[model samples]
Target chain A: MEIGAEAIVQNQTPKRAAVTTGADRPGRRPSSGRFRRLNVLVGVLSIPLFIILWELTSRSGIVNMVLFPPPTVVAAAVLEWMRSGQFFWDVAASLYRVTAGFLLGSALGVLLGILTGQFPVVSSLLSPLFQILRPIPPIAFVPIVILWFGLSEAGKLFLVVWGVFFTVWLSTHIGVQKVDRGLIRAALMLGTPRRQMLQEIILLGALPYIVVGLRTAVSISFYTLVAAELAGTFAGVVYRIEIAQQNLQTGQVMGGLAALGLISFIADRLFAALAERTVWWR
Target chain B: MSGYRSTTKLALASSQPSVKTVSEQPAIQVSNLSIVFDTNRGQMIAVDRVSFDVAAGEFVCIVGPSGCGKSTVLNTIAGLEVPFEGEILVEGSPVGHPRPDIGMVFQQPHLFPWKSVRRNIAHGPRMLGKSAKEAGAIADDLIAMIGLKRFADAYPNTLSGGMQQRVAIARALANEPRVLLMDEPFGALDAQTRAVMQDNLLELRDRIKATIVFVTHDIDEAIVLADRVLIMSAGPGRILREIAVNLPRPRSSAILIEPTYLALKRDCLEVIRAEGLRAFNQSDSS
Candidate 1:
């Protein structure tokens, strides 16, 4: 009886395999493979195709060449800016402002977030005030910041810091509050002291959210950097963009915009890589 | 077996002296333990004056249907539940806060996702101010006991459910608590894995010798693992009956097929079915 059952099973196996392979091969597999290859080809051509179209549009006089510079003209302008040594100084100044403001803002935000998230009294005292101020755009503070600091570096720092602070603070606050109560209870049962509870359990538990907040603050820092430099700056990429716009050096303006985009893109990618490392478990 | 005992001894040396003095007292005492929760409707009684004692080194299982507050009672003993009207003493002291002497394994394992198996097991010792080296040594011993030495450096997410729960059990044991409370630790696993884990736990229990109060709804599981099974009724939960298991030790889930085990299970199910029918009829009439 067992040998007969085994013989029947062996006979049935090839038929099922043949049926599946026959179905998969003729219609499904090759078409899907071809479609996937087409997708890859299209993705690879995407940016170059856009650049060629942009170049043709500018040269064809569909738009003013001066205002809508060709990619070649933008590239030339970027090269010229680099050759003049101003590009290095502009990048340095912008980097300094963003890094300093981001560090100070995120530090304060995390400290206050832990305080407000952990203690109801602290939340009651500061949360209402923070909620009121958080909705107002940091760019709106440009005028007030200029009046307070009068074109000094401090005014620029203040604007960027303001922009970065709220996002980090809100996310951190929510993250801390959302930490698994089970984890806290488990930690408590294991005899974790109050201080160690915060440092080891609460902080680490909320870290993924905190990292997300900091990444968002990275972009917010860039956005505020634009507003700050446009308000007033001695040397920065946005300042150079403004100068180029006034002079009708449209190519240079476009180049500066491209430079800013590239820098922000790099910053975001860097932050994303750092975020993966920050929340290593995920 | 000898290596396991000595390692446990060295790890528990600090607390060993206190154990002898309190040997006569029950490891856990819950007297008139009533817990009420304020739901949206009104004050709902989760546990209604339920009381029990687990003697030193005894294995007790609280079996009940869902919402019967078996877990709440276990949590109360672990000091994770509060604002209850009653008294609880662990190792002869009134339980209010979670003491290091009482370790709990929650249903979901609740292993720290960020830490490796070894590090997760090491956490309790580290929290109690043992040096890093001491904690690592303690964790390694548990890692071997649980038979997860190969996965010691693995993160919680990488392990299978049974393995993760094993690590959680090991982590709870790291502190060498006098009382170990488990709240349906195997409830979430598949049937095959759950049976294996039950057998593994029975084996581990012999060596650990900690007073264990396990809460579960599985009758077969309770009969397989416990020295005494407390059957609880739902809706303003209270203990319906207590059945003592006279099953021999060095037992496995294989004994689940034994005539004696089936008899004990039948007694539990009868009490549960009677209460369940009464509850259903009363609700239907209302």
Candidate 2:
């Protein structure tokens, strides 16, 4: 023990001397600092500069003004949307569909995933059926959903849930299967019963992969929402966009696109925050 | 193989009284144990007709090179693996699936990431039908025993490798198993941590009553901790020789520098060297 402490003390002396002398070569320091500040300045200007360029081009008539609306025109359309009551319904309807579909799909996916991943017999029964259906895009089912439910909320929810289910299921299945063998052996020796193994070891071991699956499904849920609303809906962001396009309300179309992008972005950010807390140990 | 160093010469003077009553019964007995695996290439023999008995409260170390099947033997005793040719008895019953009375510490700590140090140690007790309060008390005592009281609430990722292994050991002991099997528990640690863990294990072993069977590839570790060292040869692994280490107790890493310890190490190494040469010649001739 004394020898180990002496060795560490000896290692510290040279490190302390190096830290006291700031720059080993002074010539390269200032240029590197300037480049880093320049990079940040350019990054801050990128979006505003693009907006200004679009305004100039639209006003200058470089392209047809009817088709190429600028940011200012889009903002005005958004303000008009807020003045009416429909925007609230549009946002609420879309948020509700995304939230409801995500929860239902994720619950079913995770439960079945755990069953199939942990049990060979369950995998043999369900994995093939899921595998066959998983490759079919949820958007491709819009026609069938319309025929089955005729633009009801159930049809919309079904599409969004379909988009989410497969991604979550496959990831959870792989995660459960890939859980370290050493962990199971250790748990077995510690007297963990087969029934309790799921709660005790498997779920927590596979949590990181499950969180990743859910994060991906968040974006996928939004995509299926667009398909569902576009197929047919009374009041939704994507439905509004479709209505404005038919009337050639180009500014409103652009505004709806921005709103959809913003909401999906925020949902993704929120899920990312939740994911960090879920796997807190990492 | 040296009769002059018969275990009785040192077992008589040892301060550890358990050494005197070693004949109480075999805590673990393996008679003609063999393990064979079927691979794509054909069948392979892992352990071939090997047998040994671990006396109650005895600390036996199985030393060998990699793939010597020493760990396979230990795993079979713990009921993690099965032997095809021979039967194993732990206390008087035939071996099967993992029983609550036999504990194992693997090479990796394998601490549950979601669990705090205390919860990890308490898991075994809770599974055995202990109440929450009773389990918490057991976990607290072990947290103090392993000297990790401050880390009781900390999760596994926050711990150092040595600290995690200490918790794993504590967790195995929480069940108070009659037999403790360790498969190179300190093999993954660095040299300094390995030495420190070895010393700590020595101290911890004296306080616990579980009969220990530790498997390691390192000869020094085997000599430092074992009452009897079982040297094994690789490729259809078999016990090559048994060296009864009559070394005194209250021993530590300091024994590595002692003249007597050096002589004992020499004897174990010579046996291993001869076994290696025999295997090499056989493989070449075949």
Q: Please state the CAPRI-style docking class of candidate 1.
A: acceptable
Candidate 2: stretches off by over 4 Å: A1-25, B1-16
lDDT of 1 at B64: 94
User: In model 2, what lDDT does residue B36 have?
Assistant: 93
How much is the lDDT of residue A226 in candidate 2? 95
Candidate 1 iRMS, in Å? Answer: 6.0
Backbone clashes in model 1: 0
**For candidate 1, the TM-score of chain A alone relative to the native chain A:** 0.91
Against the unseen true structure, what C-alpha lDDT does each candidate score?
A: 0.90, 0.90
Pairs of colliding residues, candidate 2: none
Docking class of 2: medium
Error of 2 at A277 (Å): 1.0
Pairs clashing in candidate 1? none
Residue lDDT tens for model 1, A225-261? 9999999879999999999999999999999999999
Q: Of the candidates shown, which would achieve the greatest TM-score relative to the real structure?
A: 2
